[model samples]
Target: LEFLQKPWHNGRLLRSKGYFWLASRHLEIGLLAQSGKQFQWDYVGRWWNFIEPSQWPRDEYRLQGIMAKWDSVVGDCRQELVFIGQGLDTRVLQRELDHCLLSAQEIAAGPLAWQALPAATAFDTEALSARPTPPMAVQPT
Candidate 1:
């Protein structure tokens, strides 16, 4: 929030939006959308890390596919946001967001300590469960 709320490039920000993982909620993905001075975050869903290998879709590529994007320690948790505006200083934006990331000591404390921090967004499993999971892409036999 501090990043978006602060005046940048003389208040030239037009839009910014993307998905990111918060240290506070390692399992859940956060979606950030900002236009001018307003922005809101929504829960996108859980990373494949939370989904047990046994529960993964039968599609053969499922495991191989996600592996390409996964990290040894954090699985697929990452910051992937884009900023757009006139006269935007990308270096400052990157530095600011990078500073917000968890440190080694913080990461070592693990999920329990991380979860103790306040969640950036709220999501109800009941509501999410009511929505159907999209069918997997068909693989050639």
Candidate 2:
């Protein structure tokens, strides 16, 4: 009976269709990708329709939502923004490809990385300045 209280508050009034989830997901990454998180390969695929040339509607809709949000924030500059959107799209596609190429099962079945194991990354800080700075001599000492 409480559902009658407000049309906006009810979960039933809300939708369950997961197609729109991309829009929300896109918002989180689109801006970051545009800002230079270019190597992100994690968000490449949400559906298993990779063999098809057609894009998933959710993916398309997600990009549109990203564009919409970008437009709202930076308006009246169509030409420049279109180029930016294209760049973003390219980055996202590259990420998907990278993810696919890295997974070995996708390569054979266990995931691509599992098949051709990549070398572990070195985390040493040898690149940083190791020389210790001498304390400035006391003014009058």
Candidate 3:
């Protein structure tokens, strides 16, 4: 998984004046392994999305928040995400993501080669379920 923030021209931070233009200027990339009843594939292509936090309603649940609590194992295991935004250039995004996929040559190199690719930081899923719960205090009936 990868999270990317669109950098402003000259690398300036988005300012108040650019709020509307930059509100949804973020990208999420995911990679998922495919499985069938009796077989599993190495990896499958997934989609990307542009996210706009500003447009979400106050009470609406956002993937960012939900993702924060994701169990790394399962969360890190799938390549799936929703791009949230407005007026996004789907073509540009698609082209960029396509560049990240493994080429036929890379795929032929096998699992060891695939594992050598650079990857972003991922959540620690094993720790998710391993956390101990707080004990409940006794209460009057």
Q: What is the TM-score of each candidate against the true structure?
A: 0.70, 0.17, 0.33
lDDT of 2 by residue, 1-141 (tens): 121122331112111111211111221111112232222111222222212224323476654543453344322111111122322345553453244232333335432333233221110121113323222211100
Worst 10 residues of 3 by lDDT: 17-26
Clashing pairs in 1: none
Question: What are the per-residue Cα lDDT tens digits for candidate 1 across 73-124?
Answer: 7676677788888876777777888877778898889877876653222232
Which ranges of candidate 3 are over 4 A from the true structure? 1-78, 120-141
Compose the digit string of candidate 3's lDDT tens values, residues 12-128.
212211000010111222222222222111111111122233543355354454345446443322223333344455666566556645678975775555545544212213222
Go through the candidates in order and give the C-alpha RMSD of each one to the true structure: 5.9, 25.0, 17.9
Query: Which portions of model 2 miss their true places by more than 4 Å?
Result: 1-32, 36-83, 86-106, 111-116, 119-141
Measured on C-alpha atoms, candidate 2 has an lDDT of 0.25
Q: Over all chains combined, what TM-score does candidate 2 have? A: 0.17
Please report the candidate that would top TM-score against the real structure: 1
Candidate 3's TM-score reads 0.33
lDDT value for model 1: 0.65
